[model samples]
Target: MAQKKARKAESSSQRGKAQKKKAAGQAARAATRSEEVSGIQAFIKYLKEVRVEFEKITWATKKETIGVTVAVLAITFFFAAYLGLVDFSLTKILGLLY
Candidate 1:
């Protein structure tokens, strides 16, 4: 009868250990879920901040944009022509030397 009681106690102890391990696993999973939720919340907050900053920007008007674009194109063309003339002149001088 004492041996039977010892066996029952040992079995109960093992079951208790298993239950504790299961609880620990559940707690860890809960912590992971909370961290995931907090990460998503932080990303949403960052996006909201970006949107607020975007609204504060001063965008150029269509007329100003067109004027700036035209100025840039004109300057680009002028530089391209100047560089082409310089390159041609250098090539002719090098040819004569050779």
Candidate 2:
């Protein structure tokens, strides 16, 4: 009867120790999660600041946009024609040499 009582007490003490270790591990994990959450919050704050700065910028009007677009297209067409002429000249020169 005495031996049975001793075994029960020892088992109960071991169970208490196991519960304490589990609680400590859980506390450590919570701290790690909180650090991760703080990093995400900082990133969100940075994005919000960028958005505010963009709102302060001046955008072009419709007329200015169309004017610039037309100028770009004209320049692109001129360059394409110039390059095509150069390619044709080079091919003819190469054929004569060969």
Candidate 3:
């Protein structure tokens, strides 16, 4: 019957639309997966470069490191003592004035 044929045609068109939508969804998922892979690859490449640069560094010897630490400690103690003396002198002078 003509009505039966028309129904079949309508059903086929709907199936075609559904198939297209499914294919588009699959393509979008594929694109997103590829982007994630590329991002991971870029990060791995950056880490490799950082490792290579780290290997090229010239670290200080133990003696040099100790010398620098001692110098820093000496300077810190000197400044601390100087500041404490200044603060105590100022406090006493202010107390006398008050």
Quote each prediction's TM-score. 0.62, 0.55, 0.62
Identify the runs in model 3 with alpha carbons over 4 angstroms from their true place.
1-37
Cα lDDT tens digits, model 1, 1-98, are 99999999999999999999999999999999876757788899999999999999999999999999999999999999999999999999999999
Summing lDDT over every window of 10 consecutive residues in candidate 3, give the lowest-scoring window: 33-42
lDDT of 2 at 88: 99
Q: What is the per-residue lDDT of model 3 for residues 1-98, given as tens digits with 9 covering 90 to 100?
A: 99999999999999999999999999999998877757788899999999999999999999999999999999999999999999999999999999
- Candidate lDDT (C-alpha), each: 0.97, 0.97, 0.97
Number of colliding residue pairs in model 3: 0
Off by over 4 Å in 1: 1-37
**Residue 87 of model 3: what lDDT?**
100
Where is model 1 poorest over a 10-residue stretch in terms of lDDT?
A: 33-42
RMSD of each: 11.5, 12.0, 11.2
Candidate 3 deviation (Cα RMSD)? 11.2
Per-residue lDDT of 55-84 in model 2, one digit per residue for the tens? 999999999999999999999999999999
